[model samples]
Target: MHLSVSCGIPLIAPCRSSVKLPPPSPGIFYGRAREIDHIIDLVLHKSPARVAILGPGGIGKTSIALTVLHHPDIQTIYTHRRFFVSCETVTTADGVVLELLTTFGLIHDPQQGILPQQVLLNHLQSLPGGILCLDNLETLWDVETRATEHLLTTLASFSQLTLLVTTRGSRRPMHVAWTRPFLAPIMPLSLDAALQTWDAICEVHNEYSIKLVHAVDCLPLAVTLLANLAESESSKMLWERWEHDKLEVLHTQDSDNRLSNIEFSIELSFRGPKLKDDVQTVQCLSIICMLPQGLHESRISLFADAYSQVLPKFRSSIALLQGLCLVYSSDDGFVRVLSPMRHYIQAHHPLPDHLLSQLANIYCDISLAVH
Candidate 1:
């Protein structure tokens, strides 16, 4: 379990077990104090477990995990043994294993023809009370299912190590045994959290700020991007521009990271296994985007029938969207599309002329029936 002083990685300290988590994320982090507290209790105070932070992209899953990693309580336990491996760029399970090995300075010989899984398990099992974080795991799991499954299975043996994973989908692959008991689903920031985030960054909270946050579905990424803009642009002007072209306004100018744009982030979720191959699901989402916010399921059925599909078929598509955290059901049974998703669908996947005409006619008929 010990790490040598000459490991060649400056990020690791010369302790028995050295920490190698990502540098703390820049800017104000809000609304996740409770989440951090809960994760700390689960990992440290409770039995060894694998915790999954499930949510839509850009919903701050990674941020919350990082916060928990650096928390005072976690620091006290895993002071020098915390490791973070981002699965965003890794395409295979072997890639993930190597990343972890490199993080811990446990390089294996490629010529030996030995799999990294065995080496990793042996090391982690012997290590004591360390934290291992795997972020954006969907990227690797989707392509390398068997390898990812094997990796998780091996890691499960390390009762002394706590494992954390984040993904955009609600369901973890069943093979991984990431059951409901260890699940932590993250939704958009609450209105208060969103506003507090805005004011914390811009030092101002006004009507326009509220409108801007709500317009973006109270997602933390959008709030931060727009709040950063509020420093220079007037709130009124920022809100107006967001309404006109939100996807562009949400783009971060500071970096070349393609996923920095809120639109890009949501689009990645659309590529989940269920929706990636289903054109009907995408079209249905676009049509749903055209409806008023919180539109009832029955109204959606009418619209779907006008387009020559039955209510059940439409509901199926909605279920797929909901599974991906692209939409949610309100307390009154209305389905609500997240705001960034609404704008993305409207801007990037607009319905054709025939669907648009039928949608309008269906709404008219419903309006008449209601009256």
Candidate 2:
């Protein structure tokens, strides 16, 4: 049966099929109420809600998407039709289509002469409507841009279907009219939210906890890791370890998963297609990571002039870094890396001495100009 509204109320009943739903919303989520509400409103009230939740690695994009999927209002409308597919392991358009078929139990039969994509499309067409959450879509899109966009365009053709995507980086996949007032890339948690999360995890609220969160720039994953450590180690000891180890200490003992390890999370971005082999971009990022404050936007020309050899492609490199969510531009016009990312980059990818000298000379010129 199709979804219908009566008296401005949705009269659609939940699907009765026995398909298993995604896991419940996170047990200890905090600091994302506004985002959750916005996504819910769009899915329930807007037409063709093709929402892309983009952000850096470990920024809780998947968690936010999961919360929206399991939301009461969402459950009422899209019930058994909701599908959450992880594109984390797939690397091609065909791979994504295969994932969709697998999620829907529509195994392709070569003897039946039906393409996998067509099988998925036919299955969805039979349903009233549904929401598809493609988590970590960048794995496919970054590698096979053209074919992936074609697949997205075809998927977007379904007027009844709503698409929710969570991917690393600030850029959304092209070929769809994503909901207006585009959701900016998710930022670090507010101080209060960070502290609340810390206290909830470790049952402690003190100066060391406050300093610990700030030291990680209030990034949720980093805060969560350090808090987990706080459960066993004293807050003071954690802080002292942080002072020495930085991102190294932001992982659980003997665990290195991206969610639990801040360094692994940053490594994913650093080794992403955008920044992996781009020497100039890597150099630019290393410089930003070393800067105590950040590289100001206005200083681009000065830096370009001073470090002409290293920054030959300075502007594009900066854009690439921002697109990957490795660095961000603040309201103060300075582009900065998050503390966890800065620590990771500094420890693993330190700039060469000659390049550092060039950066220092530019700073010297800027200081002289100010005086």
Candidate 3:
């Protein structure tokens, strides 16, 4: 495909039959060539558009965006001046506008100590159109629902600029004129894809294929972490220990303050304040585990009421389960937990000892009461 030099728009294929792919970067880019193609179309297509790639955290949203923007066979339109803004730091919509103005070397003095939406609109209208990348787009919205939506709507309507956003939030206002992938699977690696990943890892770490896959769970972050870990220990020995306690080791909190990569990710999920009845909650989940694969929810509910003595809000329990990424709410309002329970039930990071004692006391009280 050829590109228009003056306007930076991608043009018709010079030789319709022979399509060439750009050279890929050597870093940790995984699946999603198809998603990247759509993104390239949005940004380099002959019109202005807003593109968004939305998905779960640590799921390679940023990596995929970088791949399209940096492709060596890529058109030079965006690379000349791609503005990378981290939306996580700038706290408000006004701040986001100010940040852009400052980055572009424009006079950024807010007229009345606050930027009017039109002022931003006019400024963007004045500047030479460029690709504006906003990562973690859902962050900085705070609790102001309307303000976030309003800013998004205004940004998407910019006359000449192309905006690409990476977020884990819903795509509503930002969905205006853009085209990007809407689905949210990690896009599982195919056999060819798997070989590509293993070859990439083996080139550096010299590990066997199947053993590496087993240790890392085949996720990009997991593979990267374990590949680095292989420099210190033989892959065989590591796999042996990992087989014994894979989930626990994945969140290995004691490894020199270094996140054993993917294990470090779960740390974010643990940041909020601990549950008030955490001891009982842990106990409740453990009891639920003892049941069969197709365990009944009513049975679990009855055990929760009996053992905890206090009836917990079913909603709170459901929210906790969701936050753990362990369970999903079914159509019938039942909760289905995800695989591999030993991490929660028998892992080192158990509920507080005090909470455990309190849970035991509650169970004894309930038992006596039942008699």
Best candidate, lDDT-wise?
2
Q: How does model 3 score by TM-score?
A: 0.61
Task: Sort the candidates on TM-score, descending order.
Answer: 2, 1, 3
Could you estimate the TM-score for every candidate?
A: 0.86, 0.92, 0.61
What's model 1's TM-score? 0.86
Candidate 2 residue-wise lDDT, 1-371, digit = tens = 01112233322222233454676788778999999988888887887898999898888999999999998898998888888988887888888877777777565777666455556666666668889898888887888888877777777778899999998989999878899778889999999999999988998778999999999888998888889889998999989998987777865664657777677767776555776788888888898888888988888777767767756997888898899888898999999989888877778888989998887887787799889
lDDT of 2 at 295: 89
Candidate 3 per-residue lDDT, tens place, 1-371, comes to 11112223222212112212222434755567877776676565645767777643445666776676676534477445456566656667777765655555445344434233344455555557666667666565433445656666666666667776776433334326555334333333443454466557655433454565643435555555655565566777767767787755455445533235454443333332343336445544543443334234544554455434443644456455454443444456455432234243445345455545655665577589889
Best by TM-score: 2
Error of 1 at 168 (Å): 0.4
lDDT of each: 0.75, 0.81, 0.52
Off by over 4 Å in 1: 1-19, 25-27, 111-113, 179-184, 254-259, 271-273, 298-313
lDDT of 1 by residue, 74-137 (tens): 7887787887899888987778877887788676765645445555655664576788889999
The clash numbers for all candidates, in the given order, read 3, 0, 0
